[model samples]
Target: MTNLSQNSDIADDEYLSAFYRCAYGHLATVVGTGHQPSRTVEIGSGRGLARLSGHSWWHSDVLPSEALTLRNSAERLPFHDQSLDALILKDTWHHIPDIEAFLDEAHRVLRVGGTIAVFDPYWGILARFVYRFLHQERWDTRTPQWSFPSTDPWDSNQALTYMMLRRDREDFHRRWGDRFVLTEYQRHIGPSFLLSGGVSRRTAVSGAWLKRLLSWEERRGPWFDHFRFFHVFGLVKQ
Candidate 1:
């Protein structure tokens, strides 16, 4: 197809592109609307967000790439205290080795009222099953601490988001409630992610059909606790 991408870093398939488009669009509204983020930075950004830069932001990751605006670890963001207006993460929060450490840095760098918006794998019933068995990432909800063992930065717990925001929210609030507030939580994404095979594998789902699925999910997404696959949650620095 003429629309197909040749870059190894960006989603090549139509369905995956549509998914990222919808997901990142939702992310933009949270990080962009109601407030102007003069210094927005997206961590573990990969290359997906660069394709749709209607708004402005810096892309960052631990590994340097032609696509990224900066290179730094989440646990130790290089920006000065309260310097950034917002931070965003897409499919990257789960990869953090230490959620608390990253949160600490997130709190330090983000100005008061700065938003941190993320789109990541959810822990609904179907999502839990899919992430634990169908996906290759680690998915342990039983881990006693927020940090996991990982020499490789890619090692991750797919359940990290759920663990912190849902299962152990009390602990999170107790530790850093005064600094950050979970302001938005919308858990929904149908089989579009799996059908597209993400950026790693390709499936031939047409863009039109993918749009229908996403539209359907939008109307009937309240079943977030059971059937949905992904979540878009936002935190505001307090």
Candidate 2:
């Protein structure tokens, strides 16, 4: 990537950092002291959006270290049964080609009362339109209809499947309801104008007006909630 303007990288890092900070903060709220399991794993810790924590085990797809572990595929996690206190899948569920198998494995490995937390886009009215028009990827309210192979993960045509929302909480509840307890639900809107691209010289200078526009849209109206905005859900194993 080309060198961006001063503090551009910092700005991006801060953006990701804030995401992790907020996720962990919310995860901590519902997960009480002992409710936290002996181990914590992050399924797709790409670029470290959700940092490894000190309280429990930390793992990611990148940045391997003694404290952090890496897994290549979500369908088959590299761990034993009932071994984790929690598993965080931040903005990664839509990318899982075999979400059913993946969640099944999560249920099998999570100790009774273990937590499975997910953060992803909810295809409400705003989300559906923004993703379909604003981005190249098409928004599909359905799940796993597109062909997704296990070995080569990136081969999917929908490179950025941002539109695959889980329909509703009751939907996921009906699936994992027996095995896990749904604990929390929260929503978020983001740096709307920032979009997702490497900063270039032309757009290097961050504009105050751009930030203001984002601020305005975040509080735009109650109708905004009807759109596919960001959402977080946490479930504890039964």
Candidate 3:
């Protein structure tokens, strides 16, 4: 996993900046805005949603950062049962070595009506191609089990989110549906992001122009759905 500059205003190209900014905004809206309680926790603090949110959020990460409120893995949260009102995960969800274990911990920590917001990669046409062939991470949709063997926190399956929520949704429900409800799911397009070259390089314009391009993508909707690269989904504990 790329260590996104922890500061909200990292030196990202305008396109990438808008892309991540929207994700953090969406995440903040879900975890805050009276949708959930105030004791919210964002698991990945690097480029955290706390900066965008109006509410105070406890930040945590597996990485050793003095800034983090908690330095822990997803599978083993240190909070007391039902002590948390919400849990937010950005790009970190796919890197967990055990999906079932993490979900179990998530279920244990959050209150009955608590929310879990996830902002991660989507399996759109352009995303599938770029992640599988161009990106360094593994994107295997065919993996039968949710667990992968990875000792390194950076190791990941980019398809993990897509698999649990889209492809193998039935399997997920069969296993954990009774404990959680899928309250919201929305796809996002980032064609301009392709040119921004992420954090590695730059080509797409930034600032007002990049914001305009992103607005254009949202306005176009279905016309660009095939190229969507990320999604924001919320789950409510039951």
Highest-scoring model, TM-score: 1
> In candidate 2, how many Å is residue 129 off?
0.9
How far out, in Å, is residue 174 in model 3?
A: 0.7
TM, every model: 0.90, 0.68, 0.88
Q: Tell me the alpha-carbon RMSD of every candidate.
A: 3.1, 5.7, 3.3
Error of 3 at 158 (Å): 0.4
Q: State the lDDT of candidate 1 residue by residue for 131-160, as single tens digits.
A: 898888899988877789888878988898
Q: Which candidate is the best by lDDT?
A: 1
* Ordered list by TM-score, greatest first: 1, 3, 2
The residue pairs found clashing in candidate 2 are 37-85, 122-228, 124-227, 124-228, 125-227, 126-227, 127-228
Worst 10 residues of 3 by lDDT: 1-10
Give me the runs in candidate 3 sitting further than 4 Å from their true place. 1-13, 35-38, 47-49, 52-55, 204-208
Q: Judged by lDDT against the true structure, how good is candidate 3?
A: 0.77
Model 2 lDDT at residue 229:
57
**Clash count in backbone of candidate 3:** 0
Query: lDDT of all the models against the reference?
Result: 0.78, 0.56, 0.77
Clashing pairs in 3: none
